[model samples]
Target: MTAPATSSGIPVSRIDPYTDASILDPYHDYRALRDAGPVVRLDQYDLWAVARYDEVYEALHDHEAFLSGEGVGITEQLNKAQHGSSLTSDPPYHDTVRGLVSRHLTPKALREFHTYIQDWADRLVDELVERGEFDAVTDFGQAFPLALVPDLLGWPVDEGRERLLDWAAAGFNAFGPLNDRTRAGFPLLAEMGAFLHRMSVPGNLRPGSWGAELVADAQAGKIADELLPALLGDFLAPSMDTSVSALSSMLWLLGSHPGQWELLRQDHGLISNAFNEIVRLESPLRGFTRLLARDRSLGGADLAAGSRVLLLYGSANRDERHWKSPAEFDITRSNAAEHLGFGHGIHGCVGQALSRLEGHSLLNALLSKVRRIEVGEPVWRLHNTIRGIESLPVVLRA
Candidate 1:
């Protein structure tokens, strides 16, 4: 990492964060970016990238400076079209929509499904462990959410569930600039959005589920009726890939580090912290773009208004300056909760409570039944805006 070029020139790096190569394994480039400077101009994308923990955390909180309303993705078209989605909105409007969502995901609401997710994990793991070997991502990572989220949100359980995974992947993929990957994902995303929109209809939703609640709110004038579809669409797009990515990464980490698993086994209380540690170590979202609403300075880098900066959450989590032995995964890592795995500030993940509940239930269930976790080579799933294992093979011993 080099220092800033001069008072006139910002430190420039030609690394393309969206390229398949970088997305496959960004830690190397992330270290390079961090070492280069607090803020480095990505010449390829013509965007500023902040890799250090302090700066990224600050940017997430200072939304007025690093605005999300312009779009959080690399593409102009999708961002413009997604203006209605809460992910692309600013405060006031963002607060209203987020508040509506919070009503359904409060601790009490999320706690109701804890037993279900736990039992689901137990049943799924039992069958997989009996087989002696299985692809963790396909069998568990993808399956768990597909089985659970739709039911909770009132989407038809069987219909289009497979496409939901693809849609979730494409949602993040489309976040990047219009590249080969972005272009490739358009059709699937369009289709999935439409399907989810249909699922938002009051008649289509389960009588007492969250999706129905959104409709009820609309009818009661809580939120606009037209925004109902976008609200429901939000539940699927962000939740699926992120949750799947985190869950698979947890299994991989525990399997690879048996000593950590033993520690987790000794005390189930550590399950929550262990989940936080897993996500902190292997963040599902590589980063998201934030457009500068006005001329501002970030980490000493001066930027004009209407500039885009990539807040590298994944890199920030492993920043050496922030965490001791940042690369090592420890279940008992006290500061693990400080990691920006779920991000921070107002735009932070709204589905996080549900995600944690699912993680806790599944991880606790595994600790109780499985004695040893033998993991094989993991197939990587690369996307411009998300990082996760696509196929993780594991053999759980009783």
Candidate 2:
């Protein structure tokens, strides 16, 4: 590893964040990046990195300085691929499209599905408990959202729904730099696009579902017809993968740290805060890049216009400056909600409300039904962006 000095005086490291090794166990690299400085240039990727919590938070909130419209991915190809979508666009237009997608996801809007989601969670946990041992990732984490989100979004039940997880994971993989993993995802992304296009037609989607609403919006001349696929994707990909990562991590974390599980079980009120702690410790999306719109001073480093900087949510969540014992998983942490796992500011996750609902419902159900959560080692998934478990053998003692 070489450290190169730049005119801005920023420390440069040769760390490759997308490597299979790095993706599998990134905490050491995250610590190195944070310890280096507030801003460190990744000489390997020719990108700047903001690993400290203060800097990441500031940059995430200052959309004008750290532009998303140019693309949040590391490579130009991936960024251009996302052009015009809410993820890559600046406000006004970003606000319009996000509003349409978020209308159904708001806390008040989702209240109608409260009982339904809780009931589903109860049933799913009950089945898993009866089985005694099952793959927590597939049987529980993936199962919960896969069962509910598509139905709410109006995806046809028979249209290769089994592949939704693969498609969703691929969509996120495409956000990374052009590695083999990223390249493999393009075809899957296109397939998802094609599927969304087919479902965009008036009669193809469930009439009253969220997907149908987007289709109707496009038909009514409210949004461009071309944007329909991206709009539906805004709901589909993120609503699945990130939630699965959080849910699966929830189980792994609770199981490994029986003390935390007992703490949560004893105080049912800690359910919401526990979810926050889980994502804070293990952020699903590691980080995303932002193109500097203009030259600016960040953390005393002079960043130039057109420079692409990676705001590391995962690193920031574990930054020692902001978090006391940042590496420790304590559900009672007072400021746990401040973590940037779901992002911050305007581009903050649109589906976070629903994600929280799902997490809360599941935890509540588990508390009522299971006394102990025993687990085997987690088989972590290797991908460019999402940090998730592929499988975990688990036993739920009642």
Which candidate should be chosen as best, given TM-score against the real structure? 2
lDDT of 2 by residue, 216-292 (tens): 99989989988888888888877899999999999999999999999998999999899999999999889888999
Give the count of colliding residue pairs in each prediction.
1, 0
Alpha-carbon deviation at 74 in model 2, angstroms:
0.6
Give candidate 1's whole-model lDDT: 0.84
- Expressed as tens digits, the lDDT of each residue in 1-398 for candidate 1 is 35446454778887777778887888898999998889888766768889999999999999888888888987677888776667788988898988887676667877766777788888987898889888878887888888888887877766777688888788788888889888899899789768866776678888888888888888888888777877887788667888889989988999999999999889999998999999999998888889998898878788889888888999999999999999998999989999898888998888878778778888877987899998987888868877899788899998
- Model 1 lDDT, residue 2, Cα: 56
Candidate 2 pairs with clashing backbones:
none
Give the Å shift of residue 209 in candidate 2. 0.9
What TM-score would each prediction reach against the true structure? Answer: 0.96, 0.98
